[model samples]
Target: MERPGWAPPGVDITTPTSSRIYDYMLGGSHNFAADRAVAEQAIAAMPHLPAVLRENRRFLGRAVRHLAGEAGIDQFLDLGSGIPTAGNVHEITAGINPEARVVHVDIDPVAVAHSQAILTGHPYAAAVAGDLRRVGDVLAHPVVADLLDLDRPVAVLLVAALHFVPDDATAGAVLADLRDALAPGSHVAVSHASDDGRPPAGLRDAQSIYARADSAVTMRSRETLDAMLRGWELVPPGIVACPAWRPEPDDPPSAHFPGYGLVARLPHPA
Candidate 1:
């Protein structure tokens, strides 16, 4: 892998990064050779991996547009946001509502640096590097509070990234903290991978490969994922497979994206 000058010191160039692999899966050029190597191995396990990644990205765009346009949401917090690529949250949201505010958060330094480079002049957007498990700090971060009023509705997007959250309790608690802080009308859009349908042995093998990279691929079931949204009101088509989540009228129907996408609105306090 041709290492970039910006990569964190002592970072293992031989190890695959979840975000970088995701970037590669989306047919983006921002990833390195190590990321490509692991991603290619995953593709070998499931030839449709790239297609699934693209479909998920399209779903993210569609979900953001729906919240901004149809739901009148003007603020967003994108968690575990991977390396910036075409049709990112800022690009899609700003295109719809020029005044929309967004905070992009990720544990990946590369992702943060790339986001900063692309969004420097964008008055409505900012990026932060933080652990998603630290829900308190992430929500209390100065930039997030400055750009977004938690007392008002904001869209929190967790797309194609939560699978690394292997511990169910930790994942649920992190989400609950955010839910507790949101005001009435706030929304959360999440997409998580699952082993809902029959899968070959190779896909499981591919998931194992990620364990060597300090990441875990934990695929959940619909019921378990729905449990994560307990306090919020579900939008129509609640917790369906990714490709089926309010897909654009023009998008082809597919039953196997290995992930689920759902948007839920927080109810107002009495």
Candidate 2:
């Protein structure tokens, strides 16, 4: 299959990716036909899928705003930042402080390509292709090293990304490594759908669709999320449902979304 102009070479465009599927969910034009097909299947399974993703995206924007505005952070490490759509991390941060630097890392080459294309003239923002699970590689990438100062306060966003890690042990270890690497006053934001209890029939079908993707969705329980984020200090209204966390009045109503969202700070050295 011929690769789309927005897609970088050497990446498979015929296979659907979670990132592109998410792009489609958010009504972005960066996704391919394969992505739309899988998204359609998933949407048929659960019509609210798109709404759930939008709410999660809003959570990311709110978290970025908090980091750039109130937390006084100017550097952001956005892991698994899907195809940039409305209210991206850089966009949210730019609105608060134009100088705030952002590095968007995604495993999908196409997403990285699209980000690089859109962020061409924006010196403060760049995109790198890397897996968030590989903390060492991601933090050491040239883009990250140049754009972010690890010794200073930075916001690391894991918005709707952890659910793909699957194993709690691996997830906990990654978070611990991040905590150890970051300086005092750093913050991390996360949003995830828990799989502790029985899933609804529609959600079950959606999960089956995601299973075909390279990084299958592996929802963790709220308890597991807390366990992984143990060292960080929870911000107010801690770890609530996605839309419930510091929600703006203009945000759409989500009646029963199961995803959780939180922003926690790493305290200063005592």
Candidate 3:
């Protein structure tokens, strides 16, 4: 697979990437044949994979809106933010408050490139290439530091991203570092794939397919998801399925989605 001129430098276009595969699942065009092939295989195995991805995306929008409107959060750090698609963090928060700042971080060079292109000339939003596990590198990124004030309440979004971490201890430590770095009023919104509602065989197949991608998938139990958000106060309707989290009246039922979402806040100091 020859690299296209549009692809960012240092990216291997031949191998499937989680970010690009996710973009393809969300109906975005930044994916290659390799990514689409893997995504299609997962979809074939689970049939409801597209719906699950859509639900996850919708959860991201709803969570961001809640943070901007109800929680009074004006800045967002979207970690492992995939290819820029509909209802991006900045777009959702900007609707609530135009001046809201967003910093999108991803390990994928292609995702970063596409996001940078999409955010061109937009002063309040920017994208940076960084690993989510490297909490310090992500937070200290020039674009993140310039746009988001760490002293203020910022919403950290890990929507559909942490499942790719593949290591419990590393993921836990990363979350802890991020939690401790923010101000007292900051919020962390997370959505992770879960093995609760799916058949073991199908889930294993899906995981096997994703394992070939640049990042492997690791589905967690609901209890483990809850534990990941330790030290924070969970908002109402805590740690429910994707669509079950603050769903709108017309939102589709979440009967088939095997993902969980929650938004928790670090309490203000006494």
The C-alpha lDDT values of all candidates are 0.85, 0.87, 0.88
Worst 10 contiguous positions by lDDT, candidate 1: 197-206
TM-score against truth, every candidate: 0.95, 0.96, 0.96
Model 2 agreement with the true structure over 19-58: per-residue lDDT tens digits: 9899888888887878888899999998888888888888
Give residue 146's error in model 3 in angstroms: 1.0
Error of 2 at 95 (Å): 0.7
Which is the better candidate, 2 or 3, if ranked by lDDT?
Answer: 3
| Model 3 lDDT at residue 95 | 91
Candidate 1 lDDT score at position 266: 90
Worst 10 residues of 3 by lDDT: 195-204
Off by over 4 Å in 1: 6-11
Error of 1 at 32 (Å): 1.9
